[model samples]
Target: MNTENAKPQQRFLPPPPGAEYPLMGSAVGGGSYNSHLVAGVLFIGLAAIGAIDWWLVAWIDGCLAIGLLLDRRTMNRKIALRAMPGQMLLYSQVALRAAVHMFPYYAFAFVLYLGMAPVVLPLNFAISSFVMLYGFYMLLRVYWLVHYLWVLNFRWEHAGRTFQTHQANLKTRRSAIQHVLWAFFLGNVGLVVRCSSQVITIAGFEYLRQSLNLDLTQHPTLNVHVMSIFWGTVVVWLATFWFMLQPTFLIYYRVHRTFHSCRPLYDSVHSIHHRGVLPTQLDSGTISPLEFALTEYNLPAGMLVPNWYWTLGQIILAFAGHLPSHDTNTWMKTGHHHLLHHRLFNVNFGLIAREDKRYGSFYCEPPQAASAPEPSGEAAPPARRRHAVAALAGEDD
Candidate 1:
């Protein structure tokens, strides 16, 4: 050991548990799987039965209304008798009310439409066209409705803390490509894989419809009921997957977020998604990631469905778009929604940032946005923390 340098000391650092080694990048991307449709076969079969006898769908819608009322009463009693926070009740009430309200409207419309079935049979494509337009309105209504209540109003545990407190720490830089890739991977792959299962099913249905040339309406006189249930079901299913499948993306994006971090870009676009703190149907995939690769696959791939049915289904999907939980509600109203996630970070789930009204879309802020200045006043992103080095892999001078 004495001579010129002898044997060098062995420097060793064991890898972290769970992950075989340190995760060098901010995010890892490309562990993807296919997802498109799994509901196709079931929907086709269901649509076939419904086409043959529309009464079943009506019965189900009726039963759902009754069940919701019963559940509402149960929760109301718990709130009234036990004197609980009524947190869940607030969201439940709105959702349940919407459910019940939509039921009768749908039923009445169906009955009225049935009456005109004989005459409207000839204009089957036209009927699908109308349904598409109306359904989109319903979806948007639900999104904002959820936003007004649970998503926009709730506060978190560390509600007022900011980035200036931690700015000294994040001198190090993290690889940006990593997180961006991750956003695509989990969301694109994880979610798509699940959704593809459903998409393929619909694609199969499209193939069948083309082969069989089936129509959904029972009126035989109008060229085999021009409206086909198979197409309609695919419309709803694909749109559902498109708008409501962001949990997978958020998971990849939020994989690195912590209660204490110097960089707070997660606060910009992503934090609002986590606002619901506790997730529920009210706070489920509320944000739109439709344009992202994970979802955009619906474009060429989605063309498999009939044009009219697909168009109408997109309308109904418009309703569900905002109905689910979102992280955007806060930014929509005051841009403060995302910061809330930095504070409580775990409580508000149905959060959405409802800003613009027309031609709206799902919004995602990059994870590095903390350093960027906010265009709006009254809201300054909290300063970066020193811990950002360790987490973000630190940028040295």
Candidate 2:
């Protein structure tokens, strides 16, 4: 019996009848619930001992969220390890490394946001909005300066790396309007909303009690109940990174796609962004105010979350996240999806491939691109671009 050419079998045998694996069972599902319980107990215990405050809780929750995310990634890797092809396995390793590299940027953004707390926390609504507007403008200008230097030193060297030859749409009336609105209006509005929400959450409770002339004095347990509600809400909101972040991104994608489809809106507003066909960091802030409001700042959590730090995180994610995708010099290959979107104009609408994959719009590096003529400043017509995308995606003509 020669076994030299035999192919190995990949068997899937079910567990024997009545078999129980308590360790695996606990790790799979019970561990997550147990963590929540432990976290709640720890939070309450710390509060009881005067060892923890809101600031501490915020940092703790962020660290816990990252831990949980990494744990899940480990579990997923274990489950999928045998199924991944060699190339895909290599890609996954690279992606993990890139994430590790990007972590410092997240930390920097966090530190920057924290640095602004002293300046913005004490001001009233009117004064804070003014400050935020000025601060936002300064932030945009500083980033622009950084990108300007980046391009000056590196652009020629990286020219071959760019997706297209078209230049960034700078020094135009459209660019000016986008800069003004994105910096002065949309971002400032979001900042003020977060600040106001924080103030209202803290003082409004006391204000309500005084205004109604009814107190928690009648029932001692009522005070406990009110406090429970307050702390519970805070804990839940703190843990939102584990739950709400993905859905928020999905919602933004849907709204962004919708705005693109609305011709009247696109022609009047959304087109301002599209003008920067080969977007650089300068174009990151070049979006219409209405589009910005409807997309980035549109999340209910932006207005409702009492944690201004969380709101600040959202702002950085919205603005800074756009920069790498818009710039060609980044070694991170994740921007290809968006650079393709800019080129084709009607595909790759989502940040990740999931949405486009489901909607039959995923264009996996068009074949013609290898020998295709140099891309021009003008974008392909909508219908032609859609056809090209459909063809590339292997859909019917």
Q: What is the TM-score of each predicted model, taking all chains together?
A: 0.25, 0.45
The candidate that wins on lDDT is: 2
Off by over 4 Å in 1: 1-171, 175-177, 181-186, 194-344, 351-397
lDDT of 1 by residue, 281-336 (tens): 22223222211222323233333344355555554443243322223332233233
Q: Measured by TM-score, how close is model 1 to the native structure?
A: 0.25
Q: Tell me the tens digit of each residue's lDDT in model 2 across 1-397.
A: 2222111111122322212111111111111112222343465576678854655445434533443342322223222222223323332333343334334433332332232222323433324332344355447656665555554345634533332332232334333333333332223322322323334332333354456653544457655565554455455545653444454455445545543443333333344355445455444554543344334432332333324444365446545544554344555434656656655556566667676655445554432331144432222234555454333321221
Model 2 error, position 14 (Å):
44
* Steric overlap count per candidate: 66, 0
